[model samples]
Target: MSTKFPEIQGGGSLILAWQIKGKEVLVVAAGRIVNLLNADAKVTVVCPRNGLNEEVAYRVNNGQVKHVDRVFLPVDLEPEKKVAMVLTAIDDPDASTRIWKYCKQMKVPANIADVPSECDFYFGSVHRDGPLQIMVSTNGNGPRLAAAIRRQIGQMLPEGTGDSVKRVGQLRRKLRKVASGKTSRDISKRMAWMSEVCDKWSTDDFNDMDDEDMDKLVRYYESGEVPSFEEIRLGSRDHVVWEFDGTFGWM
Candidate 1:
């Protein structure tokens, strides 16, 4: 007999702590979620053959992940390895709920693609800087809105932000004493100056900064307790906190 379950009016979510890198992960999606993420971690995609064969599977075929022609069945994938995260993008609530229960039993973190309330962790619209990364997410409820914001942020960034950060990272690693914190604050300050410089740099400024100027900038970052904002040469430290507006009436 089909009994109706009341739909929860508002959404709730949790961010479970589990790093999927080199760990088993099961993805159950008929959509593009798996394709886009390229199955991070030791990933496997299980979906109906027709829908799963899209670009996502193509990428997976490059030794990114293994694929099984099936729907979501927790028993099929041995979660004993404590697979890191299971992603489900299906529209079926029961299927999503079942996947959630399976993760709990296996002690694995799970994220049901579009279902944040049933997830352990939520994905972010990322802004990466090698080891320095900035991520923004709205718990998966509003990915379109999140994506729009991400585009706006892209425009705000200076040209060659990636190149600039990469250069900074190489320098930071080379200074052994600084890497070990002998000059941690100094290196941090230099990084700050670099950010300011990058932010306000004119087309000519970027083209003209010589080896001497770059060295001076590094010294400025390392030599000071206070990094002036005018010299911020890298990225923004600003953050957007995600919080739910509490207005729920229990069913």
Candidate 2:
């Protein structure tokens, strides 16, 4: 048996969690699990055969998710490979269970399928646009509910939202680097400034072109010195929080 992985409490539920401010993530799963996760992790999907088709891999379009056509071996599995999390979807209960057992014994956070009792957390379905990503999670109990929520979200969000969001985030990241903290006024002012820009973004004929422009936005955000987990109203209307640490870097 593996060691214990710490569980995190969120929304009044205990789930498998990790706080990786800046850590490499390794995903050990097949198909959808590997394709879903993205961001800061060094993701590598462990599979026994060529489970993922090329077309499916192209959809995610991320450089991560390396493929190793090999079965899991206790001797070869590096439980301590600077990995933040592991997800197993081996299609076989016994195989997935075995992998989960090993990760547990090794003290790494992990999850398995068809065994909710043993899972700490299950991945959620998400919709992404520029800087906004809406997730529909059913706590592994109701896929039907998740799908229903996804439909509602699809109706709520307008098209081209993801592209707009990415532009904003790139800009914020740039601003953060040169911005100052400890000043409430700066933060407020910057937030307001961002709001203004975003509001007129579609009409101003302004769009992010290169790395420099994105960095400029990040630098501007830094001037506010905004902290992690920022909550801002969308289009100067509805409240939306954006923390999005690269925690779920790899699903």
Per-candidate Cα lDDT values, in order, are: 0.61, 0.58
lDDT of 2 at 96: 78
Residues 45-144 of candidate 1 have per-residue lDDT tens digits of 7887677646776766676567877787757557465555677777788878987887888777677765667767777776554333455677665788
Write down the worst ten-residue block by lDDT for model 1: 226-235
**Predicted structure 1, TM vs. truth:** 0.61
RMSD of each: 16.2, 14.3
> What is the Cα root-mean-square deviation between model 2 and the actual structure?
14.3
Off by over 4 Å in 2: 1-29, 33-37, 50-64, 76-80, 170-179, 182-251
